[model samples]
Target: MFSGLSAFPLTPLNEKGIDEAVFVRLIERLNAAGVDSVCALGSTGSYAYLTRHERLRVAQLAVQHAGDVPVIAGIGALRTRDVLELAQDAQKAGAGGVLLAPVSYQKLSDDEVFGLFDAVTRSLSVPLCVYDNPATTHFEFSDELHGRIAQLPNVASIKIPGVPADPEAARARVDLLRALIPRHVTIGVSGDAFAATGLNAGCEAWYSVIAGLFPQIALAITRNAQAGNAREATGLSGRLAPLWALFLQYGSLRVIATAAELRGLVATPCLPLPVKSLQGEVRQRLAAILDELELA
Candidate 1:
């Protein structure tokens, strides 16, 4: 469940609430693309914005539509109690795994973060993926902390941030983490721009934002890397440099939501409240880039 390409689909929203039909189609798209797993409520899915009931419903919908593909439901919340409840909800919804980040309004100490995972992992029947998205969670994980959390029961994977750009350094970073964690716990990489580098450097999985919308290309790169065709994998990622640039500049959530809207995959302004869709010249440029890359 932790290996290969894990696509993080957006939870498309409408005036009433979650656009259930659109969300189902997105899951079906991922399933059709043969992605290794579907992550229903990751950062790209706007998991943080959704209420507990909404998240549980999304998890259930994803599992229902995903068919054979394993569904990893995001179970992050500000309080550990809420996170635990979400985890139970995910398990009840038949999620294959749960992705958890130490979400905090107040900065969390290492012990507090460790406690969060320790508490959740104990009650979890399904495997748990440690979601270390420092960009969104605002809590960076030290390698030692990752090692500690990984030691707990049911910890299947650690979704680490992107590695260093340099080839040797990237490998070194991954290697260092590998040594810390147990052999059974897979190391997955986030950051769409660094997928190729991280995969080639020995990351077992790519927890991708772009894959949610453009699974074919993401799968090509992941398969190439997994097959040990480094050049092909790198080339495939290089072609998407324009898209990656936009992701870096505008944040992946906004860029991908905009792309989904442009492609007619979802309604205009599909994002949840307080998170507006892209507008004006940048939106136009995104369209141009999509066309130039033959991604539209």
Candidate 2:
């Protein structure tokens, strides 16, 4: 059903490369804090920067430390064949499922979208979660379209990131979409800040970057919200609000990397090439926010 909080941590890389000790430590912390699952090599993990080999290794590490928990490996790629290849590798590495967006070359037609799934679904032995981040893909999979995708046997979930400017609209969109999918197909909200609203809108679960940093608090919010305890959810979310705000303010993947660093879970806070590192006032603000949360 994909309920509760799931941590999606950054894939740390040192000069010597893939720091197993640090990676294992991060996964151990997430497990102890009650994270329902862990996602590896996603946007927060700088998947774009990693080679195929590194991605496989990260999946292996995640599976090794996940114990009984499910590990969803992000298998998104520009090429359809490559995406399926990674999905196959993910299953081989013992990942519970794969998360992927539509082909990134251009906005895909409905037919092309279906074809993308047609190719990738064949290789996915486990459940598949569709990623619908329009900001990244420049393609928004409408609720109607997602309903169609939900019919696929391997299609077990959907990931949507709402526009932060208009949360009400986001809730409405999520609600409309949630109503379309069958009960068995889990609807997963990806944006941390929108998770509570998504849950209230009947989303089955969520994928949270903040869960990677403060998994216990994320678990609290999800548990209370799921139980229909709005007051408890709000209070716990308030404690985690500062960290979410850092992601909004700092403006990039640094928030995830920095959060990992604050927890002493990752080897380096360095984001991959082309993405700027947090610095000066922005860095100080993040530090202050982490302090306010007592997570620094």
Query: Judged by lDDT, which candidate is best?
Result: 1
**Which residue segments of model 2 deviate by more than 4 Å?**
14-16, 163-171
Candidate 2 lDDT over 55-86, as tens digits, reads 99999998999888889999988888788778
Candidate 1 stretches with Cα past 4 Å from truth are none
The TM-score obtained by model 2 is 0.91
- Give the 10-residue window scoring lowest on summed lDDT in candidate 2: 162-171
- Pairs of residues clashing in candidate 1: none
Cα error, residue 275 of model 2, in Å, equals 1.7
What is the C-alpha lDDT profile of model 1 across 1-296, one tens digit per residue? 99999999999996579999999999999999999999999999999999999999999999999999999999999999999899999999999999999998999999999999999999999999999988889999999999999999999999998989887899999999999999999999999999999999999999999999989999999999999999999999999999899899889999999999999999988998788778999999999988887774
Error of 1 at 247 (Å): 0.7
Per-candidate TM-scores read 0.99, 0.91
